[model samples]
Target chain A: MILPVYAQVDLTNGRWRKCTISAKLFEQYLGGKALGARLLTDLTPAGLDPLSPEAVLIVNTGPMNDTGAPSSSRFNMTFKNVLTGGIASSNCGGPFGMLLKKAGFDGLILCGKAPELSMVVVEDGKIRIEPCPQLQGLDTERIQEELPERYGKLVIGPAGENQVRFACAASGERVAGRCGAGAVMGSKNLKAIIAFGTREVVKANPEGFEAHTRKWVKQLKKHPMTGDSLPRYGSAGLVSKANASGVLPTRNFTRGRYEHYEDVSGETLADTKLLRNSGCVSCPIRCERRVKVKGKDVKGPEYETLGLFGPNLENNNLDLINELNYRCDLLGMDTISLAGTIAFAMELQEKGMGDFGLKPGQPEDLLRVVEDVACRRGPAGELAEGSKILSEKYGGADFAIHSKGLELASYEPRKSVGMGLGYATANRGGCHLNGGYLALLESVGVISMDAQTPKGKPELTVFFQNGMEAASAAGFCLFTMQAMIPGILFKFGPASFVCRAAGKAMLAARPLLSQIWKCMPWIMPINCMLVPHSKSIALATGLPMTIGKFFTVGERSYNVERLYNLREGLTRADDALPERLTKTPQEPDQPDTVVPLDQMLPVYYKVRGWDAHGVPTAKRLRHLGIPLPEEG
Target chain B: MAQVRYHGHLADLTGCRQEALEGTTVAKLLDQIKRQHGAEAYRLAKRSHIIVDRRSAGAEKGFRTPAGLDSLVEFIPVCGGG
Candidate 1:
């Protein structure tokens, strides 16, 4: 089997070199975030400023990328965490990953600041760092328009150029939309990277892989979560479910339910505004919504944008949200961080602590504020620093609604305590997907596993975090994992006795699950129908992969990231939520409404084989084939 | 009398967002919904996640859970994360 090749580009010297990882290491890391994390750790020093010239940025693809696997076109970007000051990895559904592979490279390792504004061009295994002063200060769309349409593009906008703390990198309309990757690009004076090639991705067993992928795609199409609900409503469909489950963030997370929720709901979007549905390359489940914004069709807001910009701001207008989503994307800003920052600023105004000329339920100046934040102009410029810094400058740290300096997603974790635990313990700080997204089972998905219960969450969180980490490294969309939930469960429904029993059974079986998780590769020898990723990887890459080994890779990935974070000086204390979420209840009469993070932290640590201080044990590292700090 | 709400596709089938219905329990409220709307609407409602007074009905007693006179009941379609 041919080993994956990576391009190591030095912006300082304007030179590049080709590098390859050993087959053994490839099996262990499995590419994407895992491989990126390992590469970043090896290339950079501890406590290095994420935006410094010395810091490394790795944009990479998994073995499944560009292959025939469904929703397999995802690429990952990893750098030092610009938000949390730890390890940062963001995934995007775009053509760049496919094109990069076709260009005879699996990844790019970039270091040093360019002497001038530059764009890296990769074509058929050759690399060039060309000056692109003409593309400076261009919005994401304009930059892409200026480039060749046939080439896969990854570009940043004004927010990135200005170093907005939550700026994102865009590839088409999809984004690696978290942890300030765009700002790092801007700091390096890199404007964009474009690639084009005609090479084909090879598979170890093409026939078997194709058959497996076809069956998997069929399963996704038949599943209720992927096939029907997602296609019909997109992710905005969860607005009603989140609202009904009392997990919807409202009024800056002070409340759980929104009176005007349906006004900005997925149902409403589909009924009134939807122009069409779209999807990423090689994806069978097309969950993206297309809506008309200012008479032009653009990408619609996801649940995070809708929840944060809608009920969290007390703004019921759906049209306004679509416009905001488009505007943020154009500006290369992260909507979740931007909206959360705005909500915090609004709350500050409410408390009379400061005046930012923004208020909840009053969105007249929102458009201006969005631009101001992107440009870092006026008082709104303070918001460009993000909520953590704003809270430190102001005095609302208690209600800041972020963990490890990154703002939480839309799910009001006070209602779904498992999600709350997830927000607190996630490696990337407040990322729902990285936190195991237990909110799926607890609040939104067909399984209704007592949203408020912390009983089995720690074990489940570890299980899912590991699974998702591995799947992402394998280059599949997290949405594909939704198919793991059996169709029979959806038929029974959440309200049915069978479904309720299953939820309870899961919680009751937590100890066994925890043991199974701890046992690792020994417990699961075969690929599971529920999880097709392991088999897919084995068939595509000639790797000896199984459900057990797949999860072990995920665990290794998680630990490697943890080690990076630890090396960067993050500790157990960094795994934290704001006081408001941990201390204050959403409902006054309901004492149990708050997130009991303290109760679950110990259990979570223990389940992950970490010590009392949340440090990965030396024995655990050795068991996972991970080198210790000194050894590395 | 309780305020019964339909969300997502349910509202399209019921032709209204919410209305006052006579029921003392969630099961009874669902029955009232079926009587007012049709079997299809009822099936959708049955499959949905029922919320009473901002809490999941499943978290309480499922279909048999009590719905008081002033209760605000919502039937929301199940959905996945974005």
Candidate 2:
């Protein structure tokens, strides 16, 4: 039988060892984020500096990955975040994961720093580390171009070389953007990792898996959220919804509305700038925007890049946003964190605490600023540390716009309180996906519950978080889960009685839903159309997979990350938003317009079976089959 | 009559940012706009959410919500997912 296997590389000595995941662990966790988290918790040393050689980085693939499943060409990277000082798992859609798996390994573990700058290559189940001094200091695009085209490559650029706190690792045009994974590679003196192979994935139930993939692809194409909106405008389509709902982060999140929102909206991008819509491999929803940057075509900005760089900076220029996004990508810096930090710097200048020469609605010198941060030059060097450190040095902690040191995304959560709660409590820190992306239901999607209300948020947040966790762990794009809302809701509109009933039903089912997590291992039946992942996983791995077992895996993954953070000294105090988000109302006239985090946290903790201190109870950990931290 | 504001592509279909439409309910107002703009607006409207006075029209009652004379109704097309 084909079992999940991993390659452990000791970069310090250039030695490689291969090991198989025990059948028990394989059955309990899928091979992506869930398995990566499990390995991280077991192998990662406690209290090690995230940038140190002792800190290990794991890249893992899911069972469906490269198995001809729709939108399954994604990978997960788990490591300690330099910025958050907690567990980090970043996902990306690129050829690297597929190549890695096809090369006869489900995952790779990198430990110890290289003695010199080098590139690690894996081909035909063999691993080799080679010195590549000539490639040092090159940008991501140049490095990618210089690498052999036959092999899939992962590379970091100047931002990572400089060890910018939120540097990213790029694979093709896709990036593992959040959590400084690139910086960890840089610290190890690794420039890139390439994978090449000529083996086909072995599936246990090939026919069943093939049937599920076909049905799933058709379902994904038929869904409006994925098939229509995403394919047409990519993620940039949310600009108008965020703006109209008063949730668009403008001018360092001081306001939720932008006056010139349309200028940088997805509609404008589609009308004026879009070359075409692109996507990852096996994806029916081509939600990638290909637009011109400089004289050449490049991947365009997503909503986070557009919103943060556009309205959040008070700049109405989509062209400038695209250029900056390209710059961030090439430099290996995360656009979300980069934009959030710049917005915070702009606010710092507005407060007369410091002058970074940044201003609202100004595009001048922005490109220069991006270059400086990537190279760690002058004031940009300080800014490269992220907003959290800058806030500590300066005094705008209230308006720093970060959670647990990681910067917030474009969604202004004061309006979407569940998203606010998500930012505060996400294990990876201020991450939308890790925070369960409840804003899609509460504010953006057709499932319009009350955006500002905290009622049902804790339960809904838990439900969505668990569901997203399972889907993400199964290696499907979170966008694939968009079909779960049912297409009828979109057809009838959010104003229809059915949509309202749908929202209310979710709210009303909170009690039952809260209990479902514990009962998951037995109750959930497998289907490809609704919850297709379980059946897909079973057919692919020959494991006894069920919808219930899948939910258990998600729960275990989340709790494992939380326990890792807890062991690393993160507490409930760290699970918080900036004062600006909680204390200052988005609408000056409306005192209650701020996020009601205080009201939601206790309930959220209760539903998660955590203590008032926000740490999971021993009973809860035992119930999920996760090990309790030694300190706990 | 209610002042119905259109956003995103919905604005392009209706050819006006804001229109004064005669109807007692949001449903009737949307029907009038759909009839005037034809299938394009109808398709966009079906995918869009109707908000009355800055709040959700609470999907259950949808167009049945009272669009009273001075209400500011919005046809904000749904393009959410990032």
Candidate 3:
């Protein structure tokens, strides 16, 4: 059978080693987040700072990557978070994953630090660590332009080179934008990594994989959410839904609604600013919006960038949002964190905590602050430290609006309480995708459950989280997974009795679902529904990829990350949202409008089989086939 | 009569953002729209969520609910990206 291979690089000594994963480990963890998490846990030394020379960066692709699977040209980077000091798995959509595998490696692991500014080149199964000081300090776009277009390049810019806590790595306008992975690359004095190869990915069953791919692409194209709405407006389409749902996160999350939200809404973007639509390799949905920034056509802002840079900072200029989005991309900074930090600074100044010279409704200062944060100059240097640290120093912990150091996404959790639970308990901290993205079901998506209610949220949160984790591990775009919700549900409006029953049925299945999880391998295997990634994986890797096994793989991956975080000194205390989310109600007259995290946390812990302290029980770990950490 | 304002492509299909339609429930309003425009208008309506008087109908009031007298309705297309 074709087992996964890891190319291990010792950056300190400039040597590389090839290691094939064992069958036992391969069976338990597929590629991408699953295998990467376990590898990082085993290979990384304890107590190592994320930016230290010794910390490891593991880039992995799923079994179906480059096999013509829909949106399968995705990869994951797993490492210690520079901001949170916890497990961080950031997924990106680009040709890099396909190129990396074509170069004859399923994954690449980098350890130690280079002595000087350097670049790693992989071509035709050969690896070369070359010293390249000329590429240092260049913007992400200029660096990419300087490199040969034939190679898929992953590069960082000033934000990363300066080791900004929220630095992101850019690849063909796609980004691994969370957990400061780019900063870790910067700390190692690594400027960029370019991959080029002509190798073909061999599928175990070529005909079966091809049939599955055709059907999968058809499904994605036909699905209303993926085919029509996304391609038409891109992710910016969600701006209107989020704002209407009272979850747009205005003014550092002080309120959930924005009056001028229409100025930057997706409808406005599509009508006035959108130039064309684009997407990653092998993706049919093509949800990317190509818009003009400073007279040059570039990737438009997604929901996070639109909401955060637009309303969260109280900026009503869509043109400014597009400009900032492009600037952040060039600077290699995560917009969520960078924008959140600036918003936090603005609030701090408003509250008389510190003077960073930022004010509400002032969009002009934002451009200068973006530059300052990327270059680590002036007051933006302190802003580069992220909101969690700034709050600790400046005394605004209650309204800091972050969970576990990383800034919260644009979705205001008080309006969607389950999202609050997700933010508080997410492994990577303050990430919407990591927190299960229940906002889709609760308020934003087709199924409209009560947003402020906490009942049955824990179970739904776990279900979405597990499914998303499995999909990410399989190297599929999360948007493809959105089709898993039956089309009939969209046919029936959210207020219909059918939709409510569906919601109730989902919540009611918690007990049976928990039992099935406990049964593990004994449970009957099925391919499940619209999520065809498992079936494709089974045929491609010759591995048994039944739905049960797929979920188990995801569960194992999540538990392993939890185990790592636990070892790194994370406790239940860290699994929490800010006071503004949990205690303060968005609608003061309505006491129930606040996120009732207290009601959900206990139930969530119980469902996950973790003790009151949120540590996974040894029995739970063993059941998932994960070895307990030494401390355990 | 309920006032309906279309968003995204829904507006393009109807050739107007706001219109007055005679209907109590969203289904009937969609039926009237389909009769006046075409199947595409009905298709767009099906895939879109109605916001009654600026509040999202996804919450307590879905398409099944009545348009309540003089309710200013907004048809926002159902799209997922984030």
Candidate 4:
């Protein structure tokens, strides 16, 4: 049962307010930026400092939570961004988002500063604000360890305590770190959020649950993307795939193809030190690979982690990288942004900028710097505010890959024009969590994209952005979207409201509605008239809702977060890729080729309803229930 | 028409995972193999810097076969492991 009507439960004046949004609004603007846009406009004030306690940090779970949504681990957190001073919202996948729903909490919105260090504990159907001196200033990994095995953790490290501009909220080894959200958490003097609940949020139908899960799990097992390849090789497989496709970013985004990528693929991991396969809770596909060095088991970093720490740094030492990754995780930091910042320092050192006090290919020296980064100590530490800060201090804004202060994820945008647009306009800055277009660019090749040509890329990118937004808002896993489609099966869960959300998502096949209706003719007997229903709340909760109503709520939440960015003073200029993708095609590994991004961006913006400057139009916002408030 | 044998990684690269591919043009063979096996697994054509009878075949370049189209063409994709 929903603790309050609709998925959004607003707490104010010690009473709960239930909001029912329309499905049209939900489909038009789903999750992440769209939800953030609505929420921030409503909640954020003008010229709000992102690091101030006045920053409204909303941990919003997507519509897909509590359903057997495969790879539906996505959830959003919006705040005044410390990086680009724009509207910022970061999405991530882990147990925390799922647990929030299970605990009967849709999302957590905490405003007003705490006088001292405190932790939010949700255990056994109760939420309490408690002080925890011991948890203060602890690194993320240590805090994760302190949590009972049954509970999920969202904690920050010394970077947050130091108010490092790029600090992240780490859960297990995954993170929602960017735009100093962790620093926002720290500014509130909040230490951690430990959540535990006994009630299982599995679907109401046990037999349907078993059959549905088994069928999808079987499909996943058979689909080459997940079964044999990703399960065994993990994301590391992308190293070679992108390299072969001529888009592996190497030597600090100078080239799309890494001549040394052979040294980093999943095949290399399988041949070398890969110790075991790992996975998230309730995940049938084990995509994480556990590696060992000196007999110390370390969480094997993903492709994004490897892209930055390995090839991006010009460091090819595999064994040493294992230890370096271990140090990052133990310190509770996001390796992607960390590597991006370090790469900036390395570029500075190579160009006779006289050592930002760094040794480019030396993993051991880099390991020492990890602690300093997390704590913002010493030379490289000061710029550890993030990659964009390092770029501003140095002279390589050309190479600094960030949007709104958050560094880019591991995908080389030069190879995937669609992905490049996704990175450029992501609400939380350069982030792949918004949408990963590599499946179309290199793996599945479903979108008929001339990846090397940039033809139709902008339109394709816009399509992916919308589809991903809808899927993630429904809270389903994205990896599945890469290979298969998540369809009407979702309506049985919170994600099903998007069944009609297809108009927003550009699909290869027709919409799920047509497909479902067509299948009904085959599955059911003749002369059956099935009527459409509104976005109804769960029967267990007895709350009334219309399909049109829920999406409006979802879109309203998105706008509020966008306003948070506007309050932070972010503008169109803040939403774009570095010169590597825009002004110049990345220098080809072959010595004379270009990624052709110039041929892409204009087309991308047209479909997105954004101006060439990358700002969403007033017409666009009005259609999606996003109110544009007065600006500074 | 010329035939190329699929072996080891190439076998995995081919749709059959064991059988060789037949084609008149080098591009056709590679495209056929990739379509069946999936592009993610067919990167062997680039990785294995190969050699036919005597001369070298460029890693990614497509080429015509020898006069004797029925000759036993060699499968020499570059094979390296760290």
Best by DockQ: 1
Candidate 2, A1-632: lDDT as tens digits? 57788999999999999999988888777778888888988997789999999999998888878888888898988899889899988899988999998788889999999998999999999999999999999999999999999888889998898899999999999999999989999999999999999878999989988888888788888888888889988889998888877789998998888989989989899989999999998888989999998879999999999999899888888889999999999999999999999999988887799876564555867899999888888776678899999999988898889999999998999889999999888889998888889889878889768777788888888877777887888788988878777887888777777777787777788888777766777777654467777788888888888878887888888888888898899999998999989999998888878999999999999989899999999999888877777743
Residues A117-179, model 1: lDDT tens digits: 999999999999999999988999999999999889999999999989999999999999999
User: Global lDDT of each model?
Assistant: 0.90, 0.87, 0.86, 0.58
For model 2 the TM-score comes to 0.97
Sorted into a CAPRI-style docking class, model 2 comes out as medium
DockQ-wise, the better of 2 and 3 is 2
**How well does candidate 3 score on lDDT at residue A17?**
84
Give per-residue CA lDDT, model 3, range A1-632, as digits (tens).
78888889989989998899998888788888878888988887778989989899998888878888888888989999898898998889978888988888888999889999999898988898999899888999999999999988888999999999999998889999998978989999988988988888888899988888888888888887887888999889988778877899998998888998889999999999999999999899999999998899999999999999999998999999999999999999999999998888888998898987665667977888899888888866778899999998998999898899989998998888889999988899999998899988877888767777788888888777887888898888888889888878877766566776776677677777656668765674877445687888888888987887887887788788888888888889999888988888898988887888889999888888789889989989889988878653
Listing candidates in order, what is each one's chain A TM-score? Answer: 0.99, 0.98, 0.98, 0.81
CAPRI docking class of candidate 4: incorrect
Off by over 4 Å in 4: A1-37, A200-211, A435-439, A442-448, A485-568, A587-599, A611-613, A628-632, B1-82
- DockQ of candidate 4 (2 decimals): 0.09
**DockQ, cand. 1:** 0.71
Compared with the true structure, what per-residue lDDT tens digits does model 4 show for residues A1-632? 22311232222122223354445444444434455555565666678777776677777666556555455566667777777677666666668877766766556666766667777776655666677788876777788777687777788887787777777787777777556778788888877877777656544345644554566666666654556556766777556545544455677777655657657655667668799887765556678879996787767877777777877777777776777777766665667777887877777778976366787656678877888887777776766677777777667788777776788877676655556766776666787755435334422222222334444455555444544554455555556554443322121111112322331244333233222321222332321101011111222122233333333333334344444554566666666678866767554443224444445555544554557754556876665545565542
- Candidate 3: segments with Cα more than 4 A from true spot: B1-3, B19-39, B64-70
Over 4 Å off, model 1: A359-361, B32-36
